[model samples]
Target: MTALTLQNAIARTEAGRARAAELAVAMNIAIVDAGGHLLHFSRMDDAELGTVDIAIKKARTAALFRRPSAAIGEDSQPGGPLYNIESTNGGLVSFGGGLPITDEGGRTIGAVGVSGGTVPQDVTVAEACLT
Candidate 1:
């Protein structure tokens, strides 16, 4: 199976971080490999320290599940088998603003995460960088 190179992961993560900062998001950004391993991270100076763990959790959840964490939250609705799935992983965040990064061929390669801004603001930053 093909994998996302570490270099690309770092580049994308940094790009996302920069975009967020440029937007005055004051955020923390993180990238995780396909296997949910952290590949890169950047926390803006104005961001809260607590955002660090939230960003990592978002990246890990997206990478490990190969989907956006917001989708995971959707799947975890009441009466759904995935309900409360977040409880299974102490470091997983099933919230919005986390998205999986896919390869050119449309296969999941990794994930990018952002925190410290509003959920939509974080999503906007991530989308801006990826697009």
Candidate 2:
């Protein structure tokens, strides 16, 4: 019902980052609008450099596909219906830590992604942002 503005993205990213800190894991966080355009991003000190791109990809994938990237990852495994789907869309990141951000009207407004930690840790941080 409403656009995902930069202010909203920044607040979400900060919440996610705080959760990551509490978990004692550095993280790279990304937030993107429905169109897969970046709204905000943050890479915590000591976070893995490589996860910067992965975080962005996760956010974009979640926003574009309108689902958790973890679900996509599960479906994209061998013998699954979405097998090899990751190879499409210039490389979709079908992994954990990507989650669609829904508005009060239950419409997807954007997405949040977390990386630089283990899958579970990343998922936890990402989910924390939704609260």
Candidate 3:
């Protein structure tokens, strides 16, 4: 139960889609395994093509770090510890919109990423999927 099943990924994606619909935002969503490998993906009809790679990268960032992508972003600032982190990992996305998906015991099993909206909005949608 720790790792997300295909059904789990789908449900998560659906939840994110529902949340994005509520906000009237079209989004590109991605789900990745604990190893940061992609599992499933969805791009809304109106989602921008530009966000596709961003969504996947966000998912990978969260999965690889076992933390929210924004957290990495925060520490990657000018004088932060992860300043050059974005340059590594094949160009990770440090901004918001990425989150680790944990099990009931609080261990990250996978991650979800969302894009095609403002940072806050992307976070909101990403959180929705994890719920």
List model 1 lDDT by residue over 1-131, tens digit each.
46767777667767777777677778888888788888888888889888899888988898888888898988788888688898876767888878988888888778888898989888876675465
The collision pairs in model 2 are: none
TM-score of each prediction? 0.87, 0.96, 0.96
lDDT of each: 0.81, 0.91, 0.95
How large an RMSD does model 1 have?
1.8
Candidate 1 global TM-score:
0.87
Ranking according to lDDT, highest score first: 3, 2, 1
As for lDDT, the candidate ahead, 1 or 2, is: 2
Top lDDT model:
3
Instruction: Write the residue-wise lDDT of candidate 2 on 1-131 in tens digits.
Output: 89988877788888998899899999999999899898899999999899999999999999999999999988899999999898887778998999999999888899998899999999999998888
Assess the local accuracy of residue 81 in candidate 1 as a C-alpha lDDT between 0 and 100.
66
Flag regions of model 1 displaced more than 4 Å: 78-80
Q: Which stretches of model 3 miss by more than 4 angstroms?
A: none
Error of 2 at 89 (Å): 1.1
